[model samples]
Target chain A: MPNADGYVRTGRGSPPVRTPTPRSRRRGVASAAALLVTAGTLAACGSDDGGASSLTWYTNPDAGGQAEIASRCTEEAGGAYTISTSVLPRESSQQREQLVRRLAAEDSSIDIISLDPPYIPEFAEAGFLAPVPDDVAERVTQDVVQSAIDGSTWNDQLVAVPFWANTQLLWYKKSVAEAAGLDMEEPVTWEQLVQAAEDQDTQIAAQGIRAEALTVWVNALIESAGGHIIEETADDPADIKLGLESDAASAAAEVMKSVSSVGGPAFTTAGEDANVTDFEEGDASFMVNWPFVWGRALGAVEAGTLDASVPDDYGWAQYPRVLEDEESRPPYGGINLVVGAYSENVEAAYAAAECIASPENQAYYFISNGNPASNSTVYDDPEVIDVFPQAPVILESLENAAPRPLTVYYSEVSGALQRIYHPATAVDPETGPRASELISSVLAGEQLL
Target chain B: MSTTTLPPTKKTEPVSAPRGGLSDRSKAERRLGWRLAGPAFVVMLAVTAYPILQAVYESLFSYRLTDPDNRSFTGLSNYWVILTDSLWWESIAVTVFITVVTVSVELVLGFGLAMVMAKALKSIRPVVRAAILIPYAVITVVSAFAWQFAFDINTGFVNSWFAWLPGVSADTDWFGDKWLSLLVICLAEIWKTTPFISLLLLAGLAQVPDVLQEAAQVDGATWWQRLWRVTIPNMKAAIMVALLFRSLDAFRVFDSIFIMTGGANGTESVSFLAYRQTIARLEIGLGSAVSVLLFIAVVLIAVGFIKGFKVDLSQARGE
Candidate 1:
């Protein structure tokens, strides 16, 4: 029998060995040609003419502040480099996922990245970031708040340029504070806030949701109690030590439990935005939130969604204390700039990053975008003060704030902490030891989170 | 048609011919079949088998996406770690609970919907079907978000609307407790996917011969009796198929739980756990192990449905 391809079967129940026919050979050639065409098309799609002067900055989603800075810095470069902004996802975890995946693949198109502080250590440890030159580092770090500087450093090296810094403040209703007889001039403890909320027949709004916000609140509480979430860091994941099973951790847990009791009925589901809404309209009188709450309130008032008297009664203070004698270490957050290691225009990227993080640009970004500047000088800017009446308190909070635990295994540690200490009302004295074990085991690869 | 060109097998050589071996003409047909299906087979392998095989290969190592260079062979320790952990078991229990509840409830509700659609007046059948399918057509994530917003304490109307009910108030947090969160997630899943089950069951309902039901009616059988004796027995294959697909889908639930609670308050499914390990934590090895386990679980569920129900797909297709 002859097949369609002109191969002949010599006999039954036996495989035939024959020379390839012209038609069969033509089919092979056709397939090979098709393969070549596909390969060529894909290769063409992969390459781009993004020249040495073109830089792509991967930025976390903001209200056009980063894009404005990119354009300003591009003009200042004067043909050295033209910076273009690529907006990443809104969530920090998603941004890290995007940049990390690209950097892992050695994608040179990622010239500059706006990285969250918590993930900076991971990127630096993985050698995904280019080393910050001493001159650039010195210029960017000068006059920057210590917390931002600390957040940007890994292994004692300044791995990222501090762009903007963020910290939580104790936002309280002035009427509630006065009615409870709590001194608005002094720093209050979590104990005091819980007491005042109970006395005023109101609620305390804190982020107890089992997400990164929960991790931030937990870290701030522990740090304010004079302990680090990660007591010691090591190259080996197994050797790292956690500070959860300590007196400070117990105190932090105690404060969390007390505050959660006074937390509104939806406390466990409340994130920063939810807390802001609660503070605006609900029974929540005291909230620990980012500086955006003030901006949000004023914007709501201006938009006619909120009464103007609400903004007049808004009061801002430093983050609540965990202990009477110790100063509160508010949660530090914000974006920092890093140059991708694979970027061909490394020098240009660094220049662009430094230009973007300059005090003047930082002040502009602060005033325009409502993001706090990392440079202390920006807090003293008249426009900044005029825009953010809480500028001084924000600066103070940023100075004393503590970044989340710096570890290459940050996700694992934070995941464990969030899991074990969530729904603040469920947190107990045993939570500290349990979280320590979970973090240690997860880091050591002996357990799953 | 081409078999006419093939040489005939000899009847005298029956002893030499292997019992299961194909004759010349059938062998030729199979060769042609392979030639025709070769591209599809290779494409399926490339798109599906390659990644699953890759996952299995990577599951043997201690790999992190960020620190790829430090990956080392660890055999099956990742699986061992997961199997031993309480968290994995808790997530598994949650997944099973969701699967059982959602599939069972959907089976009943979907049957009701299928009956309505199947027996509706012909003029209104399309409208009824389309309206029923609107939830199914909406993206799962969008539906999940809508459901979350509807139940959210701060922004949701559920609290206020149900304020007069027991344990309901202006401050009721639907996502605050483990069971409550799972309840909301299940509600979202059921609302979004019941239409799919009903559609499948409707097709099954069509396959039940009308004459049999008419005969049962003429024999003075009640509607309930006729349904159990004729309708259900005839549509067994369709029901089995619907159950299989829905159970497998519900077992792998990720989007609703992810959007609603972010796996918080102990609502994490196995798929969500895998996502967290892979994307969030970057634990490639552990995540792959979880994925491989989930794949096995899905296969087992499919096999169980097929075997337990004795479903003949050919019969389901009305062959």
Candidate 2:
């Protein structure tokens, strides 16, 4: 993963020393020497003085989907400019760190960025992103999902163009639900899902790691109960108000405690990937996860790693509610296209970003990468619906999904929330108020955590 | 790169210079020494000193990487905040716990291995030496991942093997509990680094005179006494060096904790906390404060170790 500073971040996020493959290990000495020379070269050419026509897009690491999009957009450039992608670190926080550091330095090599939705506010607040051109903004925002548009906006201004949107659906095993006598067509509550899992002696796979994933889960629950983690937010950090002391928060905490009581043994350490691994083993009866699981299960079946009938039993519904009467607000996540303020060819980069986020491209990305599209029109595409039979459910979830707290201090808020609510079974009514105080104090810069 | 090019030609010529009047020869030697060290000094300052000074300067401000324009001079408030935070102290406590446990265990285990290599069957010395170095050769991250997988309930065998033991569940999630996660982190640390300690101790063992052991034995000294009195005292410098290096390395432990538990379950070391604060949270001001504290802590540890052992670092640096 090439960070904006041209440093390779390895071993997840802890340190730079990663496990090298045998080939790299054999060439370690040569690579070390090469790295020193490359570092010097990168320092000398910190801007786009060499080739103005070539644009560099710093994309979050994905499984070849963004790379393909870059190639497609390059073709669509039609000799205007060639776009190349540099993969950022795997972790979102690391990617943000690298970009923030480089952009702070006004490194002009950063022409485009695939930014995480929660970070757009921080980047925009710092003036790292170029103001969206009116023409491009109108075209990009015309047919996109409302939640995606909301996520791309910071302080009522659209700082980024929506590319793709993601929201979790309640995936279940048909046989397990049947065994528990749970209806498939009706909206489910977290209480009912937990009881059903308990009745059938199965697990509900969900991310519970003490990271951003935990914050995502907590925010979704709270939002579904008609409460926002931050009931009111402002550009000024001191003006933020956390809604954690409300009854809705209590309801959310109760649901979490109940669900976690019956979660799998590795619930505390389980990330999305770990949850999916257990789900694929047919041990989990239900899971709340992003759309990628749909493609993953099919691929597993096609590879004969999973039972052929598992796909037949696969089903999905809207995100679970915290209360029986309230509608669920699933977690919203996605990539947004942001033009760098320091880009030499800002117009061309914006044009390429538009090309990359067009409806046709969004539909293609959805079909290929299993990431739901931000463009609502893409959901109605015949190929998208054909590939994902539950496309409507994902689209509906995206429509109602609530994003994590939108603030320039989102990192501090989310980090504190994760620390307080982790080990999900331990969350209680008091957790809400405690987390609120901690988040408030931290964001106000009166406390350190 | 230029430093690498300049030092190779005249490296041996300085030592062979003819004797002269004391003042003239000393002046010439000093000039030559400064010329030889000048490039290295500049490069070192550029790489290490600049960043540290920048960190110190940033720590005095209210700086956020994401909010560049919001920076303001805070004048030591960041340091004051960190010093008062319970989380900072907890991280320090955890780091010290890991450092002490892992280094002590490694010392005992490494000493045993080194003894075997030094005094065991001569015919198997080559095999023993190679075996002892295997863990040292494996990458830290790879070993950490291996240990993580081994302790994971879903993918590992450790839980299954311990299932039959009392109070051990077959589905135990080692990472779910704080102490257990620390245990696993220490296990990975000890597994990866014991070999390095052993290799260093093995060098010390080679310097222990066999004739002294024979004389002690002929004088009716028991094996245990000879080992405690003669062999240990003879290798005291080596032991002090090994302890200082290992302890310092262990105090900065980040890779295993990050890979195995990700500083979750209260297992975060000070370095892990710094990384989270700086890279993950983007609180450059607060993070730099933490970094400066960590640097001071490391320096204190090195000085404490060196002073405690009376190890001459000037000699260690081959002055």
State the lDDT at B253 in candidate 1.
Answer: 96
TM-score of chain B of 1: 0.90
lDDT of all predictions, in order shown?
0.88, 0.85
lDDT of 2: 0.85
Q: Per-residue lDDT for A1-449 in model 2, tens only?
A: 01112112344323333698989887997889999999999977754355447899998876677899889988887878788999887778778888988998999989999999999988898889999988888889997889999999987788898999989999999999989998979998888899999999999998888877888899999999999899888878888888999998999899889888888888998888778777888878899988888888787777777887877888899999888898999999989999999988899899999999988888888888788899998878999999999899988999998999888888888889888998898988899999999888788776776
Model 2, runs deviating above 4 Å: A1-52, B1-31, B119-127, B165-168, B314-319
Superposed model 1: Cα runs more than 4 Å off: A1-52, B1-32
Q: What TM-score does prediction 1 earn?
A: 0.90
Note the DockQ of each predicted structure: 0.31, 0.33
Question: Which model scores highest in DockQ?
Answer: 2
lDDT of 1 by residue, B1-319 (tens): 0101113235465454567796787688889999999999999999999999999999999999998888999999999998998888999999999999999999999999999999899999989988888888777877887888899887789999989999888877899988888988999999989999998899999977778778777888888888788888778778988888899999999988977888888889999989998888889999999999999999998888888878676766756
